[model samples]
Target: MSTDSFDPVLLEILGNKFASVTEEMCLTLQRTGRTLYVKETADFACALAGRDGRFFAYPRSIGVSGFVGLECLPAIEAAVAACGALEPGDVILTNDPYRSTGLATHLPDLHMIEPYFDGGEIVAYGWCFVHCSDVGGRVASSISPVNTEIFQEGLRIPPVKLMRRGEMSPEVKLFLDANSRTPEANMGDIRAMLASLATGRRRVAQMLSQHGAAELGAAQGALMDYAAGKAEAVLRTVPEGSYRFADYLDDDAASRLPVRLAVTVTIGGGKVHLDFTGSDPQVATAMNIPSCGRPHAWLTLRMLALVQTLDRSAPLNAGLLRPLSIYTPPGSLVNPEEPAATGVRHAAAIRVNDILNGAFGLALPSVLPAAASGTVIPIVMSEPLASGGRMVQVIEPLIGGTGARQGHDGVDGRDSGISNLANNPVETVEAELGVEVLRYGLRPDSGGAGQWRGGCGMELSFRILSPGSHVLGRGMERLLFRPWGQAGGQPGLPGSLVVNEGQPRERRLGKIDVLEVEAGDIVTFRTPGAGGWGNPLDREAEAVLVDVEAGFVTPDHAKAAYGVALIDGRIDAETTARLRAAQTGSEGTVFGPERDAWDSIFAPEAMDRLNAALLALPLSRRQARRREIFETVLADLPSAFPKSPANAAQAEAAQRRLETCLAETS
Candidate 1:
């Protein structure tokens, strides 16, 4: 495509070589890293970037897969402008979302960049990131959904030299050590990142020595061009049209008001545009996504997923995003301004994924699947030890099932659509924390009933063995809207959190910040199930009988949902025939009763007009005015919103108030 194009065979060889180097770099980091997140959850990544800061080679099977589109140039340029240019053994470090132009999404995600020098000039760059255990702030993990500002989240390290001439910069080291609660763990992770960078440097040097610097440079550009061409070819398959879809998060964690995320995808001529203009304003809490109003990695993850789905062999690099464009409103939740806390940005990103998935489905229905469980809550246990030090360990990284598609049933008890984090073993979690696992399995009948059943959600129930233990369930969602089904399919069950089931003092909570429990206290977390596809009546009677026997679906549920009559462990053909004939046809995409009730009041078209009007006002007035309108409507209903449905009278009053506000707005 360019003057530097090499032979097709050689280009393929070099592309594999560069990708292998980055994968090896990641393995080295994981082998050397000391934290549970690195060793088990794999919350880390490594990449080889071009001089322009776009990643040309990224590891495919390791670490966070969504970061391939993240730009390293802004952080590199900031470090260079602040402190001179390219030299051997000079590395840059930063975790400030604003300072790095959204390179480091949050303070907990520490990013490092190293310049790969050959002769007297820089050839390529080495980049990596790790989610450290803690950076001292208002919370133990430096993350809480209620945090209102970045300063409250954790230490913000601007792009500065962490290493100079192979020596650790004492001044930067001191600040880092002083600002972290787990200083030793943070330092160990940082050293592991440095080790990963060194591995990249060595591998890059060998390539330069074998192929010469000129060919290596040409290969970098050529590989990215190849990936871009592949991505464009995939986009061309979508029917040329504009599709709009909207989804909602239960709330902004700190408030009872439901948060909305809407997207309009326009596809034509081998290109796609994602417009997120009607998303809710940046919240006062930490759920804001720091995209810097640009096509950040978080905003373009689904487009990358689309390309990969079309052609698995398509190169996993920044070039995959070449055919995609994005428009995230400046102060919207997707692209918040500086000073906003982003510790829980993943919460917003999940809803963004759903909206984009829905919009694309309108254009290429067969190419995409239904919605996944769309929630990830790493259930963390923090217990006070006898020695007075606190012990923090994840009990389990709980997830729900995948959405059912045209011909395939959704996956049960596991969803890797967003982040593919591994769950902690029962023995490992028990040994680390003062807890005992009671039950960990898929929830029965949690999957939405359809011709092809949607994936089932998971259940994690445990008992705390020690007093003074606080459990944190961050990034929990889908409790309100419920993952929706499509094409006459039914929605799955909503998620719930329960304490001391069957006891006299039973409690059910929603979106907890932290819940302290005494010894012998039991806690159960049940994630929401994914949406199903096709109609339940169309499902085979034998499949329904099998699900009933396996306890995945109860006998009564099978009869009601699938109209399959089962008697004495056998399908009753006569009764089944009568039941199927009387069953009603499904209408609309099922979002469950909760979403239907809520949307009845805050309708999509009205909310779109309201959000646009709110964004038009000054930034300082947006949140206040928006909150006032929601509070007015919620004032007439029960404290628990969609969870506790409003009576006919309450619903009518709330709808009237909301309509008045929308009418007065624009």
Candidate 2:
């Protein structure tokens, strides 16, 4: 192999080879791993990193796909600083978000790093992570969105060695065993992670033996450089301008106030800048993102997606982030200080994804798609057993659909825009938990209507078989503000949780902390749908009839949204022609009636100004000031102000109150 200016053919070959090594390592872990998160959800990933501690070869087919851009340098440095130089046989382990500088985003994700030795020197590093079972804390599964600090989330393991000099550290094992509710399961996953690292080490040694050490080093650098060039080339295609957008999470689980994430993307000089200065200050909840600023993976995922979509051949590595720069204000949601609970960081990340997509859509309207369902909730059930302890397992990791792009419909019941996680099989979920799976199917007529329709959402219903069973659903979102559409498209419907549906005792829940139910109780979860693209009137009449016949679009929606009449699973062309001729299309993008109502009271420009002002104040006073402002407006409105639409008179009164507060504050 050529060391200097290696052949392009060889570079591609080597890139594939290295990436395959990571995949093989992942396969090894999945085969040996002992957890549903690994065998079912595929929550683990393995990668080969350069000496600089940045990934050069990341598995594209398996594991958490968004973490490819994360840098391992901080975690490696922290480990070395704490435990001297890493030897060939030693492996460092950590799940501390702050200590590893965001290498491990949350406590449940155990990260392991192993050094590959060749000729008495470190050639590359092997990195992998798994979202293991319960880490003992305030609740089972060790995650609660209402947890105020990291301490309440779970045990935070800093950068320490689980293995030293090829031997498992007994002290680390003792601590791990003591601090977890499922010690055997957690250790089983840990051992699987170690096996993955060993696989990577052996693979790296073989590659080094075949290609020579210097050639391997040169290949790593070349792969990154190649990816960097590709990323820069794609970024240069985005129109040179600054576009600003802001989005909101329904609320921090502990409070009614919505959490805001604002961004401004400036694309120029063949590079992009993401300025998150106007985002809300860190919340006192687990939703806070511990990005540690510095263009972290969670913060830069959209940019990476944009580039990859434009150029699919671009290598998946940290180098794709070379042309991007980021600014996250200190103490902000995106860059929270240490000890902030980050158990539910993904909830914020989906909003950040929307904000970035909205902002970039302004600059590259044709290239970007509309907002997706913008929600991912993992529904878990823990039931008391006949013998002892609780039998806990995730029923399903529920998610909604992807947004529609120009000239194409959004994908239904699948959204890989953020994390590409597979849904758990009903058979597997039923075998593990004390529940009877009743309904697991798509929610018909849920996708927003457009020329190219948005994707439909999912619905899951189950019946409890055991008494004293508890259901936990975390990271639930899109319950309030609907997923907005683009270019005259309509927003999708909001999600909901219902208990004992079709019964008198049924209750509609927007968000859940924890709900306890006895035997015979039934629970249902319906996720929101993605946003559409273009005017619904522009959709072909035949297409509307097909959708109606297929049960995807109702006959009523066909006539109302698409201006096409359908009768008895057939198109009524004459009535459709009359309806189309009489109907008037909406102008530009539509964010549904609910968002419009909220925007009337708290307009975008006014909210931007308010957020800037709140950010300028002291961190301790920001939340208080924001609450005061919102509460004053909400004082006169209904209890479910935005979720349940207000009357015209009530909206006007709320608008006046909001304006008065903004005037005084700004």
Model 1 / residue 446 / CA error / Å: 1.1
- Lowest summed lDDT over 10 consecutive residues: which window, candidate 1? 68-77
Among these predictions, the greatest lDDT belongs to 1
Candidate 1 lDDT at 251 equals 88
The global Cα lDDT (0 to 1) of model 2 is 0.84
- Structure candidate 2, residue pairs in collision: 488-588
Clashes of 1: 0
- Which ranges in model 1 have alpha carbons more than 4 Å from their true place? 1-4, 68-83, 549-551, 644-652
For residues 1-666, could you state the per-residue lDDT of candidate 2 as single tens digits? 544478889888889999999989999998998878787888888888777778889988788766533562355555555666878789999889898888888898898888898868988889899987778778878888898889998889989988988999999999998988778888889999999999988888888778888888899988888888999999888889999988889898877788888999999977999999778888888898888876887788888888888999999988898888889988889998888899889899999999999998998888788889999888878787677766567788898888887999889889987788778888988888788999998888788888888898999999998899989898999888889888888888889999999999898887786788889999999999898888888999988787777777888888888999877777888998899899877756678776776777777777778877877788778778888898898898778767677888988888888889888877
TM for every model, in the order presented, reads 0.96, 0.96
Model 1 residue 589 CA deviation (Å) reads: 2.0
lDDT, residue 267, model 2: 94
Residues 246-364 of candidate 1 have per-residue lDDT tens digits of 99999888877889999999999999898997899999999999988778777777778888888998988777878888899999999898899998898888888888888888877
lDDT of 2 at 420: 81
* Model 2 RMSD in angstroms: 1.9
lDDT of 1: 0.85
Over all chains combined, what TM-score does candidate 2 have? 0.96
